[model samples]
Target: MPKDYSLLSELADIFKGKAVPAKAEPGEVAIINLVDMTPLGIAYEALRTFAADTKTLSPYLLEAGDVLVASKGTQHKVAVFEGQEFPVVASANITVLRPKEGTNGHYLKFFLDSEEGRRQLKAADHGRAVMNINTKELSSIKIPNIQPVKQSYMAQRYVQGLADYKRKLARANQEWEKIQADIERQLFL
Candidate 1:
């Protein structure tokens, strides 16, 4: 048996990001942009931390289960934000979806990463120069009401799969490096 849900907004608190500066200064909170989210996950290498009053950013601050959505970009990517080194919030171009009680953020993340979810996001993207999906549009997107146990199981599988893939990718890169070194030695020495 399956349950039907009208839209994602019903299950979560859908909101847009705040205005962020072009650059961050020292002693400021770290902000997440669309560029920070990659296919692998959130890349913390090029973080931008700028000084902003806590009062202004406190509302936008991300919780551990909060999900970040790319509102303005070529790709529609979604990531679940667990706590990082410092306080982090999504930029104006990203949409934040904080799951309501009885909902799993990781499960929602996996669902939003699915093909159907991408299609919904694509349909909502309405911008002249860049693709954009606003809070209203995101909220209006339909979703299935999956059971809690199943959702958790699915989310766990997704996490495990991602970990396995990363391990394999690292191994492949190491092997390729070794092969390149061997070739270099054969040609030079």
Candidate 2:
């Protein structure tokens, strides 16, 4: 039998409030937007803007473990911030959900991306043509009940995979640079 999951509202008491107001400007930190978000997760390569002073932007500053869901545009793109780096900012189209203490952010993120979670998002979706999720509807969505340990394990695996891919790309670039250097030397010699 599957474990029972509860409506996100049940966990509302966990989150203190919505995102904080920005006290700085853009470029102060990495900014996440709907364009930057992809089904696979945050598309780091797609990220185009940064907040110079995150303090100036309201609801843009992000902390570790914050789940960013696209509030506007096409539904289904969601991303989670694991806090690997600091000074990250979220876009207005992205609503940030901070799980209550004790709950695993990775767990919540996975649950949100699951089939059931997507169904709820589709159901709560409003607007006739555009389709969007208001904060109230987003907060009321349901999340699956999974063991925190399992959540951590899965999250770690995903993180490691991404890291490995990044490292491989870096090595490939270095090899290409060497090839280019050799060609340049031969051409001049």
For TM-score, the strongest prediction is: 1
| Cα misplacement distance, residue 14 of candidate 2 (Å) | 9.5
- Candidate 2 local lDDT, residue 4: 84
Give each model's whole-structure lDDT. 0.84, 0.67
Regions of candidate 2 where Cα sits further than 4 Å from its true position: 10-29, 44-60, 84-86, 164-189
Per-residue error for 159 in candidate 2, Å, reads 2.1
Query: Total clashes, candidate 1?
Result: 0
Candidate 1 TM-score, true structure as reference = 0.91
User: Which 10 consecutive residues of model 2 have the lowest summed lDDT?
Assistant: 12-21
Residue 158 of candidate 1: its Cα lDDT?
Answer: 76
